[model samples]
Target: MRHLVVPFALNALRRGRSIEQFLGAAGTPEAPGIRWAELRPTAEGFALVVHLAQDIGGEGSYDLVEFPSFEREDGEEDFGCQIAVVDEPLAALTIAEKRLGAGRDRWVNQGMAGDEYRDYVRAGRPPCLSASQSEAECPET
Candidate 1:
């Protein structure tokens, strides 16, 4: 997936404004519809991924915005410097880790599980592909 890093100013979200209100005041069209999932602290300030209409011209535009964080001393504002946009799950995972320090344990566990499943399918005698097959019957990778 392509990763695009851009600058964004998101002082509004850091100011305790709801995601909807922030997006509304940020000039994002309401018709396209905006939905917030969660906020994770990134290297800059915070990372916010909002799902919007795919029909939008910049369907996957990554806009970076600076926002104020309470952690700063003297009420200093933290700047959001980088924004990354990507479509691949793996790429997204990597970006998340680099940008937000997100843990990769979950992703690693999922990959291991998928590998085991594939190995079982490929090594089974007579190749049992049915989901009803007993785990004992499947060969280990």
Candidate 2:
């Protein structure tokens, strides 16, 4: 089975380190059809975000679709899955892993980005999901 995050990130998170990483489409960098995930402490609690790239069009630009989407209440617009917020890091990590595994094929995680993903986590998980929003705040990156 394809792992959601690398072993290092998973182990680090289990040990209570806040980190983020993405795995998908090797050699494409931030091109369309890439997926990334992050686990960090937030004001509310530990937050886990797994986002998939959706081609929004315009010069290789794209948007993101958070995974593990839940059903909205009646009359609510189905934008995407809500950022999973939990009181514990392990809980968030579990959900993140599950979400990533569920779409393993689409994510195309060929295990080629392992080293780069580790560097990304060490770099404080810089925003690298959407090239179109490089200047904008990555709420979901």
> Per model, how many backbone clashes are there?
7, 0
Local distance difference test values of all predictions, in order: 0.28, 0.44
Pick out the ten consecutive residues of candidate 1 with the lowest summed lDDT: 18-27
Q: Name model 1 segments beyond 4 Å from true.
A: 1-82, 106-141
TM-score of 1: 0.21
Please list the residue runs of candidate 2 whose C-alpha ends up more than 4 Å from where it truly belongs after superposition.
1-17, 26-31, 53-82, 102-141
The candidate that achieves the highest TM-score relative to the unseen native structure: 2
Q: Model 2 clash tally? A: 0
Worst 10 residues of 2 by lDDT: 102-111
Model 2 Cα shift for residue 121 (angstroms)? 18
- List the candidates' TM-scores in order: 0.21, 0.39
Residue-wise C-alpha lDDT for candidate 2, range 31-115, written one tens digit per residue: 4334455566667777765444432222222223322222234554334234578886657656655654422222222233344
RMSD of each: 20.5, 12.3
